[model samples]
Target: MPPNTTSLIQPLDQGIIRTAKAHYRTQVMRKMLQAINDGTSIINYAKSIDILKALYMLKRAWFLVSPATIENCFRKAGFPVIDKTSNVNEMQMVLDVSEFGEAIQEEDFEAFVDCDKEAECFGNLTDDEICDSVKLNRQGMADLEEEDEEEAGISYESIPGVSHKDALMHLSMVRKYLEENFTEYNSYYDIEEMIEKNALINRTQSKITDFFK
Candidate 1:
């Protein structure tokens, strides 16, 4: 695989990755709104999310990626669909820019949908601006590292938004369902452990690799 050939050959680049990102973003917004509605300070939830809860939400989004969509992506990438097309209705991600006006105050969501002539003709960045951008990115990564440490230190009993008991119950249900349906998956792993180590949810490994084998 060449450096930039993924966009041309990867099925996930066709739409599956975009779908997952959109769903994840939507879930984040929904959780933010729910916290606000519950009169809890959204800052706490936004700042330090429970790692297990975050993984569970991401898994939900991953499962929302339909078999048909996956097959369609494979076909678009010049492969055959492994199984028959899924009859299940696909998830329609509808984002109303107007609805998000208050949620994101900086710019309208539609503004980012397309790059205008003005955007394309923007002058090159100054040396100072480039340095600032690099610094900002470094700071962002540092912040993420700090957050990861915080999440690692906390246990189920200390989670903020949802109770530990509820989180445990949800995980129990998910484990039972997966065990019944996916008998080959032979691990009664903790949700916290999975998220911490980035086990089955690693996105760097492409499904396309399996197709070629």
Candidate 2:
């Protein structure tokens, strides 16, 4: 059965989720080749994949939908055919798509992101877990220091004027929850990209995992 256009709007489209997962791996390679740029890329990559997988799982539709489906949808809608592939560091493979393929371009965000639909849950976790996950959110520094004994049990609401970085991380977590559980997802780049491009949570991947649990 052909997929429904409305179904494509789900928070994390299976197709994109698959692409993002691959993208994360590619990024890991890129960072490694760059003389091991830093200690945080690995963490970001892991969180990103977690995010991609979580979102993809929500779709419950893997390779079931193809890039061609999206292309056809665009062609029929009069959008220009933009051929591209995953963007890594400097080295990227560019493939032209005349025969229906998947090459998630940055511009794709314009069409795929339905602000209303973009707000899906990526991680359907409990409030306590959500609060704990905040520590992992990139706040422009490594989450290496000891948690203040008193601040450990606080919820997002309890905190006042959390730093912009913390807000971004918490929101990322919230977005993950909404994407995984809700019916809409509007982000083109996975939460990982959001973290790297605009971050405040600079903690280890293991820390992020331990935190939520």
Candidate 3:
């Protein structure tokens, strides 16, 4: 790549990367907000996120990027991309970061996303540093295995399960709230349909279990 031309020619730099970062930031913010609501410290909640969880979050963020966004990114990067009709509503990509209100300013959010832009990922490590890192990783894996074993000893029946009726009632409240507060937003119907489908599947499974009993 030529000097200073990467941004102009790279499809990711055009919009895809920014969109992914936005999605990821929104997810992080949601988690933080949930922590606050649950009376947990944000720092502690953030610290609880391990590499595996971060990978899962990144996977979800990438999956949320629409095909139309990709095509537009390529087109903006000087690529000859054909315009295709996408079922995905572009407005859905616009994140409601405003939910954080004064807690997170627009500039601070942008800074957080771009903070890693110039970060160096690959570097030569000293022999001592490599050995120390290996030891730390091994200890971390052992700790995780121990925790998993302890969790495995707990019976499934010991965990409380939500009833289908209660789940549907919660969804009803959500649907009602959205309908009243966000009259212009129509995607909540899709979410409601998806939840209802899951509830139906759960009810079918329960009936099967009863028949077996």
Best by lDDT: 3
lDDT (CA) per prediction: 0.64, 0.46, 0.77
Candidate 2 residue-wise lDDT at 131: 77
Worst 10 residues of 1 by lDDT: 113-122
| Candidate 1 Cα errors over 4 Å, as ranges | 82-213
Q: Give one digit per residue, the lDDT tens place, for model 1 in 1-213.
A: 444465668877666766665556667767777788888787887765767778987898787777777776667778866665653224233334344547763244323322241333335689999999999999997897778668798654566775555666787888888878886644557564655355445445669778899
Selected candidate, larger TM-score, 2 vs 3: 3
Question: Whose TM-score is greatest here?
Answer: 3
How close is every model to the real structure, measured as TM-score?
0.44, 0.22, 0.57
Assess candidate 3 and give its TM-score to the true structure. Answer: 0.57
Q: In model 3, which runs have C-alpha deviations exceeding 4 angstroms?
A: 1-9, 48-60, 63-68, 83-99, 120-139, 148-166, 184-192, 195-213
Candidate 3, after superposition: displacement of residue 79 in Å? 1.5
Q: How far off is residue 133 in model 3, in Å? A: 9.7
- Tally clashing residue pairs in candidate 3: 0
- Local accuracy of candidate 3 as per-residue lDDT tens digits, 1-213: 444455888887777887898888778887988899999998899877878888888999999888888887777778885565643236235455688888888778878777788975456789999999999999998897678668788744578987767877887888788778885756767876777787777664346567777
Q: What clash pairs does model 1 have?
A: none
Worst 10 residues of 3 by lDDT: 86-95
